[model samples]
Target chain A: MKSLHAQHHPLADTGYQLTVLTQAEVEGAHQPLFATRLREAGLLPLRPTGITVMQVNVGKMCNQTCRHCHVDAGPDRTEIMTRATMQQCLDALRQTPIEVVDLTGGAPEMNPDFRWFVEQISALGREVIVRCNLTIIVANPKYYDLPEFFARHRVRVVSSLPHFSAVRTDAQRGEGVFGRSIKALRMLNEAGYGVEGTGLSLDLVYNPSGAFLPGNQAALEREFKQRLVREHGVVFNSLLTITNLPISRFLEYLLDSGNYESYLDKLVQAYNPVAAANVMCRSTLSIGWDGQLYDCDFNQQLDLLVDGRAPQHIRDFDLAALNERSIVVNQHCYGCTAGAGSSCGGATT
Target chain B: MEKATYYNPADLAKFGNITEWQPEMGRKFFDYYGEVFKDGALTEREKSLIALAVAHAVQCPYCIDAYTTDSLQKGADEAQMMEAVHVAAAIKGGAALVHSVQMMNKAKELSM
Candidate 1:
């Protein structure tokens, strides 16, 4: 399947998605504004706690075009980060006490400089997290050594596995993805990535296959552990439950299914203040492939840059001004702040 | 204005508003309902499945909708949820069929 960008779908445009999200009413009923909810929670104009993690989107190039992908990434995507931009990121990291540098992409490995970037980040003595889609490791013979390479650098491997069942997983992802993911997990297990004491972390991410929100994170983790062990003999450290933000391809889905209004209402009704207070945007800065900065990955996808008061690009790297500037938020922010809250690492509350 | 129906989907969201009319009993019932679904001998996930099965048996649209979401939220997969409903179906069907012995006896007596 082609990405929204590749298909020339209207929802692929970030501006259109934002307009739909920000509108106060859907189907003539009041749709709660995310900012007003934040205001009620005493968190309007949400500001950063501090910058501890820099999540860099190395590129939009990816292998699989999952239905709920907010990035709208696929094989056809050609937007990739240059070596110069990566160097700027490394230089920015050098100037700060940032401990974690998260690498994400259509598949970060798809980027030609991926290995070099990982080496550079590791050499800086900072934690590296690769948001790997597990199938990428087993996609081709060239990528087979990914588990060992990740092990060598002590990189935390986080991959999305929507469900353990092939039918459900493949329904959202692609055909034969579950089998490839299982094969990849076994390879990681052999490398001691998710073993008891290996320090090499291999975490699986679970997002609901439908429009509904995910279950309790800890309970989902327990069920995943039991089923993977008993059924497929696969094991992971923890399951990170991420909510599907209504954007890009997912926005297209909501609209096409006539579920846009109801899904937004579900999110608005499920909004939790504690989750709002602990949103990942409070501490993480999202750097786009071209070095443009965003409040978070979702905001990055929407082309919502950081507050203008702060440096707009990674090359500038003003920690103080960035920390002082308020985060740019829209209705899609509801996804992150709904229920227990979702982040790259997992649940906030 | 919108036309009113026998079962308005919008009314489900207003379920909590029952307390506005009769605060004391409503709050107590809700408190008991919440406590009943917590993890005990049966996990919350298990209770959700049971609630879903019961929701189907009772044929409550509000409950079916609520428990379906609740069951999924508590980590019950689609297969497990469907099986729960089938259990409800079997029981409901069996209850009506179990009186076959009485019908057979009445038929035999009338014939004699």
Candidate 2:
């Protein structure tokens, strides 16, 4: 693969004309046309497969407000899952043969019932994956012992570390986030989360701090391993490279910064049909805190409900109905189908 | 002389430079970028408009700069482009406000 630096440079001429479109102009004209194209790409109306992983978005409450966060999570948010909703999740898990229990949120740990839910799932003897924001472990004094709790359950920790450096990570996240993240990582390591040869798995997530898609996952993982080991003595199992979906706070960043067209062109031109066929939504089922089903986490955030003959909430979850149901998609689906493709687990292809 | 304290437009435009320290990754991004803009199920014109909309969604000055140009070159009129951005702003703003219901409920319970 050729380097991105060589392709688009400050001085390189790619024979493509660059124009500046404003927020109003883009919203009015380009969006409709883009939607039409998505339909042509066989991505307009998406369909679902089955419910393998039940992802419960615990809430919008988070300690940090990163610039590119798709969830737009911050300390100010309070939309947490109630105990009743959590009981619904446990009921679904008990009745279904769901393989993975994926938990997410502003900082899923911020939920008061987070431990109870984890304990219930762990008792069920199912695989559990936690989308940890890393800093939460050190954000509050009460959360200090979270490492021990996670280690005891053998929960797979998938934490976000935009970059290994303080400048880059802090820039996308917030001031001093990198320092706290490092401390949290060290604590996880102490609990045998990312140490080599340990069965406990700890993976890190990386999304581009700018408008473009992230680099190759394999290569980026190599660099992250080396830098983290040398600089911060941090270790992790894998680096899951994620593409910045053009939604939420990230979308605002693109338009506010004025690079929307080139970035979308980058995603569209890199549209990999192979990647599209293997999109995470094809096999994974995303569930909301209240038990509603979605094609993926992004769709969940958009409030785009899944298509099924029966009701879509967990209370009415029918595995067979969801298995045969079609996934809901739109123009934004292109972000996942583009290039190597993107998902919470990493590249689709 | 004291440096300008205000957020620089140039700084925003040069935001891509943050990845410069990793030239290998930079090259990979360029390759994916080249492919992302090529003609596919989406016409270059359609892709440009989507990028314009997403630029607002992500709020990248550099991306907004490049896609605004791309959208116009693809013959998207001013009204069309602004509408795409409004969709983004609506969703972006709505995402925040919709969750306020949760806050409202919490506040009510706390007051009781």
Candidate 3:
């Protein structure tokens, strides 16, 4: 079935096929439904909503240095959140009613005060999210009980699993990473994280290991469910289909491989306005490890701060002011606004 | 599943044959491809950088090799290219971390 799908959609590699025509293209062709759908999805192009979602960059430390890792994170990275920053984050939380607190870093778990920050935010009863690299739980014996710790605090755990197959996953994340991730998922599932009727949501994330954007999220979710259940007895709540942003190490890989032009064309042609209108940065607040603020994690890394009178660092967080501040964007912003739109959470559209 | 040959730099440099299965689509892509590389909303250099960054994010060896050269040719220095790749890494990393909520919630349900 996968092979058949690949055959029909030849753009599976570079994702640069012109499958859907524009209204102009159809006026010159026989088929028009494809063109109509493209128009409805706003793939034809237009600027969409611009809003601020405070972004924090906790640090540059990570447990895995996957092939496509944009952060260039590894154990070598010493940058991390200071205790002072954690206090700032808490202060911001207290003053701001931001819908989401997006805590990120090399591995947010690697931060010394990761749990404390989660505890504080959860105590305030705000939606607190922590980006977890699944292998971190198994990276060291000290972190073996992270599943329990995260559960105790009600912190949402978002993990990366590029594919259900071990080969593909290991290829990207390094040897043994896939096995540890699966073991971690089983641990999460046994705890009722991905099972039906459980509010404990365990949503797996996938990006194409190549140049293409992922196929339909719902369909891929079904395929993942079947494969995982049959092969590994794994289960998860949903699958987030994300387009790979053409920035960072991934960009290096593209240039090194001679696919730069083709891939960019794919992203440009696939731009979906619906995705742009609901981009995640509009609703999510990102906090750096030291409590500095940005519009999103992407902008945070670029050192693009929010514009307004609010505290730049978490130490002086004023939620109302930050929320009212305008977001800083660049051409890279198109990545989040293109096709189905991508965010840490999933497809915004 | 067909066993695919993963290319190294040496092998990739020798790569030249374009697949001929979709002649029409391939020609169309080439035409649009030319226009896309032209400076518009995105400059040619900017597009090259974006592609290089995405190649790493997607972990495509072929793309990584191709775009690295394209970015450099288009005047993107090593630092700019590295910075772009870092952007991809952060987003990818953040995406993974955000989903941990499932594990936390599940652990709570079972522990209780």
What is the CAPRI rating of model 2's predicted complex?
Answer: incorrect
Candidate 1's iRMSD: 1.5
Candidate 2's displacement at residue B81, Å, is 34
Which is the winner by TM-score between candidate 1 and candidate 3?
A: 1
Cα deviation at A167, candidate 3, in Å, is 2.3
lDDT of 2 by residue, A1-349 (tens): 1111223522112111112212323557433333455567676554555667888899888888888876666776667888888888788788889879899988999999999989989999988899999999998789999999998999999998977667768878888988999999999999999898879999999877777677667756776787799988989999887888776667657777987766776676777777776788877777776677788888776677888574688777677788778776665666887778888898877
Task: Report DockQ per prediction, comma-separated.
Answer: 0.61, 0.02, 0.02
lDDT of 1 by residue, A224-286 (tens): 899999999998898999999999988888888888888888888889999999999999999
> What TM-score does each prediction get for chain A alone?
0.98, 0.88, 0.81
- Cα DockQ of the candidate 3 complex: 0.02
Backbone clashes in candidate 1 total: 0
Model 2 / residue A102 / CA error / Å: 0.6
Weakest 10 consecutive residues of candidate 2 chain A by summed lDDT: A10-19
CA RMSD for every model?
A: 1.7, 20.7, 20.3
Task: Order the candidate numbers by TM-score, best to worst.
Answer: 1, 2, 3
Name the fnat for model 3. 0.00
